[model samples]
Target: MAGVRISRAAGALLGAAGMVVPLAVVTAAPAQAASCTTSTGPYQTRVERFLGRPVDGKQSAADCKATQKFQAQHGITPTIGYAGELTWRTMNTMLAQRAAGKTPNAAGKCPTNKGRIACVDLTRQLSWIQDGKKLTYGPVPVRTGRDGAETRTGLKKVYWRDIDHVSSLYNVSMPYSQFFDGGQAFHSVTKSMWNPPGSAGCVNMRVADAKAYWSLLRNGDDVFVYGRKPGT
Candidate 1:
């Protein structure tokens, strides 16, 4: 390591291009092999039940793989096949979202009087479209803005839309974008919506869901966003 250093005189040497540049060397760190564990987590049984595996609460190689796959699908961290709180919560949210499809607006939380509208329930991380009390589209799971950049709540309208929109700020593909709020819209991302630290104020949806939203909603359609996302 000591011999790797360059003296002041040699620090700025002329390159072959005739440009004086810093003489520096960098050594890449060795990459460690990813490991999988069979150690049972606290929520092992719960996870096993959710996955329809044996509810013995014991971790096996197959169980690890299954859990790891779930973690990766949901963008859970570490992806080491652990059935921790984060993973459990994601599972629960998914269950709730599925259940919501049946009676998405049963609570009468969103106004059903609107002719055709999109409703975003931040608390449940769900979105759905309705046509005067008739459920038209989802009660699908969504990823909302996280923490400081929380998705604003209020009644808004479909202000703009771009089918193959590229975000000017983030420089990412925002397909099937239906903008209802300022910089916030309903769009599709390749990422798992269940992933944490959520989206940048937009309602991130799965590919199919977004396509459905694009087909059902049009410009000037009412959009009502309310409630607060859990863990936001």
Candidate 2:
């Protein structure tokens, strides 16, 4: 499948444009391709079940394509249009959690003091900008740091804004970055990054949502991050 193309120098320049601080390179591995087959297996069965199909454990071209669609929608990586072991496991976890429930925590942890703030509930994997109780935007899907590198919680402020920020550490594009905590920003990442493998420490958003955030938020706006990621 096709991936974003950019030279090292170009990436560095993008990082520099964002005034990124130098840091150790993140050693996370890129997404890998998995083998596909038409044979039946537990993994295939789970995928079919999640898709509301007969639990026959059989793979088909149509099934593979449907899996790819699911992967893309959820930001799964190596979306090879097939239901591999990793794909099945990720889907199973998400299904087990039933994470799409609309309600956030009843605690209302978001700060009302600030005129407009970004509220990120890691537990729901959702975020929104609000003016006190009034909703301005969101509750959009987000991907936070995985097990090894959990995104820091608590209150923060939008100290920086970078429309074309690149990770100096990972040499990866981090578009529409709004830096709150040090080295941990809210930015747009590839949809594939949301699947089996996850972010290093940043809160990942879709490109359109990130752009919307950029437009809604201003420098020094309050940002509240609370709750735990589901299925961690």
Best by TM-score: 1
Query: What are the models' TM-scores?
Result: 0.78, 0.66
**Error in Å for residue 18 of model 2:** 17
For residue 4, what is the lDDT in candidate 2?
37
Q: Measured by TM-score, how close is model 1 to the native structure?
A: 0.78
lDDT of 1 by residue, 1-232 (tens): 0112323432232111122111111213433424677678998999999998889999998888899888776667778888888888788778778778668898998988888999999988999998989888878888888877788899989866778766433445677877666557788876777888687677888899999999988989999999998776
For residue 14, what is the lDDT in candidate 2?
A: 39
**Residue 139 of model 1: what lDDT?**
83
Regions of candidate 1 where Cα sits further than 4 Å from its true position: 1-33
lDDT of 2: 0.67
Candidate 2 residue-wise lDDT, 1-232, digit = tens: 0013434653454355343232222334645545444555457777888887766777777777677777766556566656666677666555533553443433568877788999887766678888877777866777777766767799888867778766544566677878777667788865543454556667888888999999999978999998876546
Candidate 2 runs further than 4 Å off: 1-49, 55-107
Compared with the true structure, all predictions reach lDDT values of 0.75, 0.67
- Model 2 lowest lDDT segment of ten: 18-27
